[model samples]
Target chain A: MKLSKYNLGVIILILIASQAILAFLLFLGQPYFQLQGNSFFALLLLFFILELAALLIYEKINTARIKTSFGRFIKQIKLGNYESEESHIIQKYDFVNITDIQIELSELVGRIQADYNEQKRYIENVSHELMTPIAIIRGKLELLIQSEKITKSDFKLISQIMTKLDRLTRVNQSLVLLSKIDYNHYQDKATISFNDILDETLNLFEDQIRIDELVIRKDIKEDLRFNMNENLAYILIKNMIKNAVIHNIEKGYLRIKKLEDANGIQIINSGAVIHASTDQLFKRFQVEGGYQDSIGLGLSIISKICEVSGIKLTYTHHEGVHTVTIQF
Target chain B: MKILIVEDDLEILRTVLKYFDSFGYVLEKAKNYQDGLAKVNEFVYDCVILDLNLPDGDGIDLLAKIKQKNKSTGVIILSANSSIETKVAGLEIGADDYLTKPFHLSELNARVKSVVRRNKYEGDNAVRFNEIIIDTASQEVTVHSKKIKLTKKEYELLLYLVINKNRVLTKQSISEHIWGDFIDRTDSYDFIYSHLKNLRKKIMEKDGLDYIQTIYGIGYKFAEREIE
Candidate 1:
């Protein structure tokens, strides 16, 4: 049986008291007490030393066993292995009186998992339900635009409505994507070449780049490859490049280069001066510069993908220049 | 052309049916799984638009049944689930294409046409609108029998416009068609404008009539010029 520290201390105290009482009884039987060169007293002292050593050794072994089992429990929890059999935990640590706490923890984990699953399901359902209505509205508008009786003013109004509808679709899709990321839907990891994704993203926005008259520069001596979900890598890089292009000034410049001292890439773009705090920009619905078309979710998506992929992201703006770095 | 849409949502089904009514196709719809299965057994449609989230049955199973009934019939899975895994699964189960929910009708119409064309054993591969012709097999565009060199985006834009000929294609639909919802800027309409300009210029250089019409404040249309 394992003994807690307090219980062991109490038992040791009781043993000492009993030993003292026995010595007193011995003294009571004797005419006088002697300490020097007393064989009986020496025998008592040797017995006490052996008993203490045995107790210490027993406590040491008990503590080590408890430590190992507790460590395993914590590691299991950390790894999200909450579905492991609670009976196993109880049976393994029954002697240490931790079975009750283990049972309680397992119950809590079960409750949390159920709640998380429910929340994820709710998100998916809400998004799915919203899609049909959006689709209907868009289709009706398309039908309206095809009518010959509609005047120019009517078309203008319809265009305005269509713009807002497009924005709604984009916002909804982004939210769905964000929730998916939160639920760890993108857990697949593979080695992805950052340079290839970067080039492809640049090509996608080539028209915008040319329209803005932005000069592009690539300073990578070698390709930077990192392990992450390929989908997320594409999204992250696309959003980054899109941000750089859309927010850039006329005739501005964009520079992409690998970090010299770190295994990551940095993007620097010339843009108008910004007064918003960097922290505010990373948040959802925090639109800077009053760009009307900005849905304000790009940065958050990038940050979210980086967070799930275990990459470090940093953003800074100074004197009309913006720099975003991703460290893997 | 003959097509069937199997969807549980009545409003979406009605809207799709109404939109495709002008296309003059024999369009049919089923509100549940059993109705859809029976229809598949009864008649052969050129294409079947299947919604994965059916009230009565799984869409993937229905897709397999359709393929079993006719290997040549095209099936396009329309779903609200835009996850990559679902898309890959649908395609793996003999689906011709997969379109996510809240999609443009014009895009859907284009997909239906493209799928029907591909499913035919001896189909005409060229998509022609007046003097301009697009050879789908080679992705080549020729105006008045003179081939014109166009960029990738230009080629796609021309084909999208020609396939939905005489219809007012919205800027949003066109952008989504070419860019696939990744580029989310209103300024992308500007990219559309620039590409269309180049396409028009190239066709005009080949002495092709100017069939592209800009409906002010709405979008562009490819059709015959009305004698005004």
Candidate 2:
């Protein structure tokens, strides 16, 4: 039940003005009744009741309204765009502006995105800049350790230190890559092979399957070609599979199949039931405590791809099964 | 190689200097951009690592000075400010790499190695650390004498790491490099762990030493050699 600052302010002003006007009229018009001292008190009571009723009516209209983030601004600009709340966060915010409200909402969302991107970029650069010197230090220290002929235990400790350094480098690598994806400046086109893409996606998940003792039912057709970037396809499939794997009953049934429907080539993964709002199902970091290793960018990246490429991606839960479908 | 490190914070400088001590390179330090300018005028450095926020002045101005004095000398600017405008300006004014603060020192070292390698070594296709070999021309990765099998992603991942080997390659960079605009938010990084594990296993099975080191709460790195 979030209301815009403007709407809240207007409601408060209306309530206050109504009360003040009603109080003034009751004070001025009380003598017209001329009921004398005791009756005058009764007249004042009636005026208070009337004021209260009026205030209640005003509160009802203002309090009943629970506007979305772009609600007020959307109305102010009047893009004449209407969308169901069950559909998308994007539904309300997607516009190039024509109305003032639309322009304001658009700018606000852009500012948010820019802020996140800037933070992401900052961390990435910092981590990357820190890497090489850490590496050189680790390298030089390792060289010195060998030459100095340090104790076996001390050498082992040095190895541990190096391991920590390695982790930083890896984290930095992921950060920089994530930041770049967030910016979305890279739009280089490539001939993507979906068949090979499935193979690679499987390659990514093979170890997880082995560790979990889970079975993957593969029903993919061979030599499927698409004029899209293969890397992104792999990301989409991988995230779908990840969702299935992470949000499943222990040793659950995981199905990976590609079939053509009216939408396009659909990659469907079936797992346990997903209980959450359907609208934000594809949003980044939707799953809570399902997996900590994920940096909450998988589904986000997938949704971004679907947005940029005009592909249809949907998630559904029914009959105790969660299905993520991507139509390409 | 002679290089100037322009930074304000003593902790960062101390840590960086302590880390680079083993590199055995001719290193000059400056606490502010004014001192940095003085050093640039006094000595001829092959490269300079400039930090943006200095105690006295912004490193950006010093960057232009260094570039004007000697275009051949490579200048990699460091900044706490990572605004797009700053990045564009830094690069436009002839600064090579712009790195933000609170970063892993290992990644810094890698960037330094690359800048130096590119500036010093002309078209060197081979990068040799120890037993492993990354040949740019042949596009072949070999450890000692055995041929290790690698997936397309794994190969690209390794090549990216090795090229930026000494530096910290953030997980985000790794995912983007491998997947690009096709990232799915549902995808977990655990998959990356598996690949890294496999890559390490393959290298170890061939009797080669493990160059890959994990930096806790960060990312992986190819640990630098220490010369005591």
Candidate 3:
């Protein structure tokens, strides 16, 4: 029986008020009942007993009332279920102080939501505004390279600059994509088959697969469907396949299998053992030594998407195989 | 080929104009929304290169207007907006192709030609340059009518060079064109060398004509060179 500050205060007030009234009654009745000493004592005792009963009743009733009403409210808040429509009024059992706290808490939540929206808008705006200038610079560089006056050494240097600029652009674009996904821009979802998406994504890597002479083995179950943004799904599967292929050794084996419980998909590839810890691998810009060509945001983006979607993602390395599993 | 470039940035507009002019493409220019819309309404172009963000109005609206005016004209949206929604919307309406900004000009050149070919020369799918013939649909290449086996990257490299036969594509641009923005900056793009070498070898095996020429220190060039 946890008592709120308001309920506790109310009980204290009841005790103080009851004691004052009893003292006053005794003062007023003292002269008239002075002659009957025993009766006067009984009267004082009865008044004190009644006052004590009143305090006890108030404490019991209010404590239970507040516990039932505000306990659920706090639980809902803990669960992140912000209910703005709820008036915070427990019918027929409202405490003034509890009402005040509820209003303040509601206002706090509203402010948090507003701040979140503003930050999202700012990030998206920065991303969109950054693209134009990056494009202009890239275009200008290309034009400069195309000019006949530039010497061979100058052209080589300019090409290096172009490469760096391209990397910057990619990082910016990925940042934009991450924020967009975080903000639920791709909200329109439909039932999609992962098997089909995986097949198509594999087709995209057919060239790289052939070039590396990789052996691919698959045991994906047909018709494994999930509700998600199809484009994101394709990106997810593509990134995984790309990671497997990019890191795998030449003539390595790439294996993909659906979990027996139909809860997830697993990919295992024969590659050099990853030196970075598992947690570091998901971190942004944490690329291993040999995989220098990686943008390093691939796994980070995958991790972010999984986080927002309530999916379980895990990574492990054993012997020479790197394994990634995603449980939907 | 006649091309109309609708771009607000003066540098890009002028650069594209000069480059396209060298390609023998009669070009038209519009800097903002009103001028671009007016030009779209007045004349037909073999291809219209449009930017999504314009000064006066939205590029998507102009794209819709162009499609309404002339369905036959090829539309390629060149925009800095990388959102998938915008790409889908542009294509859903009537745009023939879409190219995100910071793109290799050579890649744009190839895409524009492919769009033009698809729209204008619907039946003729093969791109020919002297002895080399490229069938776009079948992804086949033949030198002197001799079928040659080339890897996917090699095929794309050959097709890219053939499309922009005389133009000089920088090594950086060639890497971007083939790898599609996946190549890292720290790593040297010398990997493109191996792909280019195999392609050259295959073509040379078919015939003694070495079409691919190294432009000293800059990059490789595919042109009709004097056989030494």
Candidate 4:
């Protein structure tokens, strides 16, 4: 029931052609018509030009409307506002063909949104379910060891096994945190000092930092505040610093510089230049060479946190110094 | 000390009961919300280890019931969910401390002792073991009335060991307790050994009795030396 502008243009062209042929036939029957036929032909040519001009104007308005509406829809999708996809795109116009495409796209988006949510829930539920048993197993093992039920030789083996379980627990916690960040699960937000977060995060690595004899140069301004989920903020900064220390050489230097604009923080650490492709650095389970202690989820979690928190993160390596800059 | 454990998981319940048996704690157990609530109403306890998940009801409601009945009993929430919201809710509802699941038993033991000590003394901050004394208020440790300075980590390590005295504490448990979740389990705990050495040296320098015993590649223990 809908005709496109191109179809209308074609129909108008055919009508003009038929009228022209009829006019020519009529003119052939009258000799006086041939005497002023040049002017008459000129008038007909002007009419054709006017019709084409009108068609172009109509097409221009039509395209502008479509472009604005579709542009808004795509913007909403990018901004993670999927709930408004149906209502914003449902306005009826002289765009029946476009309406068909919109309906199909809406359905496709709905399916994908549903699928993504299901997977997110699955990750959350599975991680949650895994924790209790892991905890119980750890408890039982500790109890067994405490009770001296095992021999001294077996104690060493049990301790090793416990370490592996600890790794599993860490991985579970990290995955749960990732899904939480991905789903925007932490809702409470407050203006907190990034300086405080960094200081607190660094405190966790005090032993390692001391043992490694790493030199720290800090240029953070006092009380640099940003609004974010407190827990996510802590994890983000901690992972960044941890990555720096874990990947650094003996007696390496760590430099933390806050941007003059007060909108970003940069961390530089002296280490062997990262040999992995830039693409692989932030990937999960992509541990660097000889860094067996790392499960490689740290940077991936940091990336997800940055995404959800609307912070920009960039990594660059120069002169054996690896730098990560986070723009708030 | 009299302690009550309200947990539904059979394995955890059995293990906790068995572990606490060695500590000589007068213990009670409940498996559901109703049972736990009824027990909380009926008996006075030094501390209650409450798990957040209970069949037939929520553990939060049970926590409320326990608080309504006895405001003095210390409650430690043991939960699998480590969300901040849950922790805040539990603490706001009068829980003393929170421990996420898959924790070391030694850590749990330490937390329980801390809670019980805090409740029993009601701001009485001194912990005494023969010739040594730890003032929780001052964060100070003394040997035979002579002051000994300890690092923050050394203090925590000493407190954790003393609280779980006579029990063989593994290096894994010790590291987990002292460093918390920040510890990389795959790495060697030579750092813990260093801290232990410092604590032993500081205690020994003050002419205090050295109670810390290494269990031959197992872990360290804080107990009275058996007169051999």
Number of the top-ranking candidate, with lDDT as the measure: 1
Poorest 10 consecutive residues by lDDT, candidate 3 chain A:
A83-92
Query: Stretches of candidate 3 above 4 Å error?
Result: A1-114, A148-151, B121-126, B135-142, B145-154, B171-179, B182-198, B205-208, B215-219, B226-228
Q: State the lDDT of candidate 4 residue by residue for B1-228, as single tens digits.
A: 889999999888888888778788999999988888888888999899999988789999888888888887999999988788899999998999999887778888889988877777456677788888999878999899999999999999998888888888878788878777876744437788889899999999989888998875668889999999
Instruction: Give the per-residue lDDT of model 2 (tens digit) for A1-328.
Output: 4445665676568657866786677668767854576766666667667766666666555454423434554563343222223323344443332246666666665555456556755776675457546545544553344243456566557656655654454455444545554455334457667766666766665545665667677676665555665555665666666666655555666776665554344434345454676776556556544554455555676677666555777867775576677676
- iRMSD per model? 0.9, 9.4, 3.5, 2.2
TM, every model: 0.86, 0.47, 0.76, 0.80
Report how far residue A143 has shifted in candidate 4, in Å: 2.0
Question: What lDDT is reached at residue A294 by model 1?
Answer: 95
Ranking by DockQ: 1, 4, 3, 2
Q: Is 1 or 3 the stronger prediction by TM-score? A: 1
* By lDDT: ranked, best first: 1, 4, 3, 2
Q: Write down the TM-score for model 2.
A: 0.47
Clashes of each: 0, 89, 0, 1
Candidate 2: C-alpha RMSD after superposition: 15.0
- Candidate 3 second chain TM: 0.91
Report the lDDT tens digits of candidate 3 across residue range A93-133.
34435667766765665566566567866986787677767
Q: lDDT score, residue B92, model 3?
A: 96
Q: Which DockQ values do the candidates obtain, in the order shown?
A: 0.61, 0.08, 0.29, 0.41
Mark the regions of model 2 whose C-alpha exceeds 4 Å error after superposition.
Answer: A1-267, A270-273, A277-289, A295-313, A318-328, B53-61, B79-95, B98-102, B121-228
- CA lDDT for candidate 1: 0.88
For all predictions, the C-alpha RMSD in Å is: 8.2, 15.0, 9.5, 10.0
